[model samples]
Target: MTSPTGEPARTRGPEGPDAPANPLTRLPLDELRRRTSMKWRTYPPDVLPLWVAEMDVPVPPPVARAITDALALGDTGYPAGTVYAEALDAFARERWDWDGVVAERTAIVPDVMLGIVEVLKLVTDPGATVVVNSPVYPPFYAFVEHMDRKVAEAPLDPYGRIDFAALEITFQEAAAGGRRAAYLLCSPHNPTGTVHSRAELAAVAQLADEYGIRVVADEIHAPLVLRGARFVPYLSVPGAESGFSLMSASKAWNLAGLKAALAVAGPGAAADLARMPEEVSHGPSHLGVIAHTAGLREGGAWLDALLAGLDENRTLLADLLADELPQVRHIAPQATYLAWLDCRDLGLGDDPAARFLDRGRVALNSGTAFGTGGAGHVRINLATSPEVIKEAVRRMAASLG
Candidate 1:
């Protein structure tokens, strides 16, 4: 396959001596400041904004062309057809070797979070308990509660992987009174880039089966897995046929503004997925389907380039943090561009992000908002140029002095 621009969509090998030129570094600071996205507009000009998960890199050429074509033809109606699902099926087969996903078993929703909320509603009634891994995406707390559901916390281990022992305890507690519950699983977990192993996920499926709990996985960051790490979809595991998974090209290809994501149903949950209200399908934007499909079908080479750039930035961040601020410890993430830092030793108190923003003029996500294990932690986006990562750390170090 070739990109819209006719460039061959070659799958580049892992990052090594022959890595291509860094596309991230090509975007200048002045150009970035002109962006109207939340990352740029959320802070003052002098404050380096690295808090949001948005990437600073330009999108793949094919995605841009697809969007432009939609506008030119005035094809911005409600989304229809199975193009997005078909593209995802192709990408998954080649990328993950998972064939459980078929276009017929998927539905396009506005985005991953909303898709997850809808799936949760299908499994649990209002006021039922919903289990989540804390220090997770903050929206997990808000959206679940918004649905009139109760949330139970299963905090991750010290190493940032899921605490299954603790999770079993929480699941048992939540399952009392015959209350239906669901687990909001974040594979290639956010805040901390812990790409869950296949065994761990199978164990979760086993626990869910034993407890009669439904599992809803948010896999938005699956496509962004860095080198030395692999992402496993929750439904791909054996005994996971009852689970639901949500994925999108938004995070990997920077198409969040386009507003489209897929909610996939395992074989066992086909009836629940088919029962999803028809009105829910109308929420996805037509242009989003076109752009996302193009991304999945023709943007492999571009994605490979992006993973290479992020790989470099991840290493640069570790080196910079060690040289400039050894007190702030970061475990180099295995998947997403996010870096969860242990800032407690910095003597910055419970909320280090607040101090960093006020004193260092660098904005970061406050760990407290992520719940439980989040205190004394901050999530940083490392999806930008190495220069930006270095400068952000430099400014942070100077804040202490």
Candidate 2:
């Protein structure tokens, strides 16, 4: 393999790792899965919990080095050094295809969704009405309501697809109700894994434009799309300048515990954020910034490999559901590692989460938590080793049987 300069490609494996010998492929499925997941409670060191969105993969080398180097200085107050925001620019230029999207327009937020909350606060007034499409990331409503704002639910259509017409209508009504600044959306939507296409995004932008409302696109999961799937940035889409794009390496690289993210906005939006509190971005977690930038700038190789692992686990999940619990239709995810399963067949009353825990000995995110459209669904994270994921499915199968 030759490099762009015609030299031999760097010996680093696809994801640029050293490509260690006999890499840890898949651990013992059932035991390891239980051991990790059962941590919610003091388990007997058994029972892997595939419930959380965290992946079991190791961090890329550069990220680890960056964190370690930052800590070596023993200065973690507020990142007043040089390397703090270095990764943001490089990452934006490369991975986001931004060419030169000005890191100055990007602000490192404490958490991905916090950026959303801040946007909602800045754009909407107290008691303002905001529109949200259901089966959304449940926290979305909480953010709106916490701000003393009103929430309007426009559930997604059957099969968990967005309804552009419905969104447009809701936008109009919300605008009329005086909460014109509405939440644009959750991408690769939380439970469904449906990757909103360029067309869908356009429709959303168009609706936002129609009502003179701002769009807050929560693009936290943009990097986790299925192989070959296209992710059009909210700002990249036509008329997307009316909105802002929220990005974080936390979800893709399992860095959520670090609590770091950024909001990349357009010229108008950037100017709005500029006048805000001086502490709004206060350092953005120097360690997290390093890891994030490394992931975006150099983690592509690692991401490619990780995505391959996730893709395999995704298939394992689908086939296992079919071969085992026919009623548990595991809808294939187009992006993100979360698997949305139609578990209506089990037919338990409201909140089947407890039922799965007690009987199936498996933990899952009950669909009802998401929205009106999540009545009989469950979201599972399959970002662990294949062995663990398979066993988790087996346990569910046995319980169902």
Candidate 3:
């Protein structure tokens, strides 16, 4: 059987350097539907899901081999040792040219978001304010509030970047009540995919120091930066010694289901991380550490190939939008595979995702959940086949008629 795009659905074998330029799109839609990931199972069979952050690609061969070898030897006990942390340190130095990440100062956690929540608890008190950039990942709102904390949003600038002036105002407000606050910064931000420059990060570090607001950066998308953009580790900035950053290979290698992440503390913030309870360390899966480590240490070639494919896909998306949905404005992301489309001109109401799902049978993340400027927008996942992306836009355009 064929998918909505008229492409035949086929399951893929393992991926290697020899795989297609975009190995992600090689999997057939019918085979993809058989998987149990949220990206596949969250919607009805007819709905083309392009919402969640999960990539449709198979794991790199090295990552896959690491996991399989462990399972063969029944090595699925509790995680042990500093291999994961060491691998990350090596990857960071090689990939981003940042040597600030000390393996001794890092700890493994179940995932990046959980690490953020745990780190926030260390920096802020109950009911204290937590600052975030609006039009951000939805979980930033949910997780912070789950801690009984108040969330303050500093909306992004029109160019989809951190609004330094607005951020300073928010930081000042967050610190006004003599309450300790935390800034949840999304580097290479979600939805918009704007990679922050060094100057921008420096400004943030200055503001955080001025207001005494603890900075917890979610750098999960660090490795997925496309061509022409750079991913800088927040800790690499001069005055960011007190910042805490959460890193993971999950997003880069499509290993979210395995669940392992690292929380790195800047030189000044090591004590804060040391205060994190011992029990939290037990959440990371044993196999997850192995898988993620393999991806970091041995999967570099696979990652390079994926980036090239994603680069092509991004360019293709710009062309498709221009030809098929000219009314929709997209910035053609510089980092992540997510494309933030401004659909306000289409006159869709506050919740365009709902209309798209109901009318077009394409599932996209609702922009309303992103807060503030999010209304009349939708976040589309660009990690799938070019054909699927073209088909999704075609369906969306047909829905408008």
Q: How close is each model in CA RMSD to the real structure? A: 5.0, 5.4, 6.6
Model 3 root mean square deviation, Cα atoms: 6.6
Candidate 3 lDDT by residue in tens digits, 1-401:
53222323222222675654566667888888999989888899999999998887877889989999999999999988889989988998888878877887898899999999999999999999999999999999999999989999999999898888999999999999678999999987998988887778988999899999999999999998877667778889878999999999998899999989999999999999999998888999999999999999998878877787788789988888898889999888878889999999988888888888999999999999998899999999988887888899899988988
Off by over 4 Å in 3: 1-20
lDDT tens string, model 1, 1-401? 54222323334444677654566787888999999999999899999999998898887789989989889998888888899999999999888878877877898899999999899888999899999998899999999999999989999999888899999999999899888899999988998998888788999999999999999999999888777766678899989999999999999988889899999999999888998888889988888889899999998878888888888888888888889999988778878889999999999999999888999999999999999999999999988888888889988998998
Q: Evaluate model 3: give its TM-score.
A: 0.94
Q: lDDT rank, highest first?
A: 1, 3, 2
* lDDT values for all models: 0.88, 0.70, 0.88
Model 2, TM vs. native: 0.87
lDDT of 2 by residue, 1-401 (tens): 54221323223224435643111254444434443333344333344465667666555666787678778977466644333245655654555565424567766677777887777777777877778789888788787788788878878888677887787777778888554567648886887887777777787777788788788888888887766455556777777775777788888776876767777777667876665566768736767776676677677766766777777778888788888878776558778888888787777666666576676777788788887878877788878777777778777776654
RMSD of 1: 5.0
Candidate 2 residue 203 C-alpha distance from true site, Å: 1.4
The alpha-carbon lDDT assigned to residue 129 of candidate 3 equals 97
Best model per TM-score: 1
Q: Give each model a TM-score.
A: 0.95, 0.87, 0.94
Comparing 1 with 3 on TM-score, the higher-scoring candidate is: 1
